[model samples]
Target: MRKLTAGLFHSIDGVVEAPNLFQFDSFDDDLGALLTGVLGRVDTVLMGRVGYEQWAGYWPNAQVDDDFASFINGVPKHVASDTLTAPLAWQNAQLIEGELLAFVKKLKQAEGGEISAMGGISLVRQLLFAGLLDELTLMTHPVIAGTGRHLFEPGDPTTRLTLVDSQQTAKGNVVSTYARRD
Candidate 1:
């Protein structure tokens, strides 16, 4: 089965929105190297509608996401959205219309290496609830947003996870990788 990993940057308080401004220092060369290595092994990266929209506005020309734009542009990305149609701003992108759980389960069986979900709180919430995620890579920042979009919603239930690895960045970010426990 293909692995679905959730890679996110968040606050220690669990707020996972608009983290770059105050958390830029949290990303360092070591962390960059580690992320690069992880991305290299993944066959595909997926994103939600809003996240895709946000990336569409920026990545095609600039690809601020990484020097991996060439790789990202070429890799298959399955997007979950009710409003988006085909012919995304980025190449090799597709739209998942309905029944996310089955669609993702099928995707996991059909083809590809590790598939990753990188953005959007609503979509992540759904996937998490469906128990589709296999691995999680979280970078916990120090600052808290307190009001922006959060990765985990209020009353979100807890799920068991096995801590596979962890590290502390120079800027106080706690980088941890967890695997969903059966």
Candidate 2:
């Protein structure tokens, strides 16, 4: 079975929204290498409607030479959405209908390298709540954004995770990888 790994960019205060506003100072070759390594292992990308719409509007036209742009534009994207229609504007993109959890569970059981969740707070929360996520990787920058969408909210289900690995970049971003305690 394949594992569903989530990759998220977060602020020191756990804000996961608009990372572009805070993550620039810490970006370096080390971060690039980390992103390259993570993206290289995943064959599939999963996200929610909001993230899908936002990404589809931009990534397709991004610089072709960049590793992230190239990978995201070419990789098969699966968006978990109920309102999105077919013939998605983005290449190799498809809408996931029906039950979200069931679809993800089936995908995990199928043959694949790994299913990576790019950045959808709602989707990640659901997957983590359902015990469907296998790993969670956080690239936490050293900034405290007072308010934004956080990865975890009050009344969210509590799932225990084991810290598999962690490292700090030269710019002080902590790259932590956690595995579900199952």
Q: Which candidate number has the best lDDT?
A: 2
Number of clashing pairs per prediction, in order: 0, 0
Clashing pairs in 2: none
Scored against the true structure, residue 38 in model 2 reaches a CA lDDT of 85
Give the per-residue lDDT digits (tens) of candidate 1, residues 86-154.
766677788876777898898889777888886567776677678898877888877765656677666
Error of 2 at 177 (Å): 1.0
What is the C-alpha local distance difference test score of each model? 0.77, 0.88
Candidate 2 lDDT over 1-182, as tens digits, reads 99899978989899999898888788777888898898889999998999999999999999999888999999989998888888788998988878989999999899989898875889988888788888888999989978788999998767789999998988999999998886
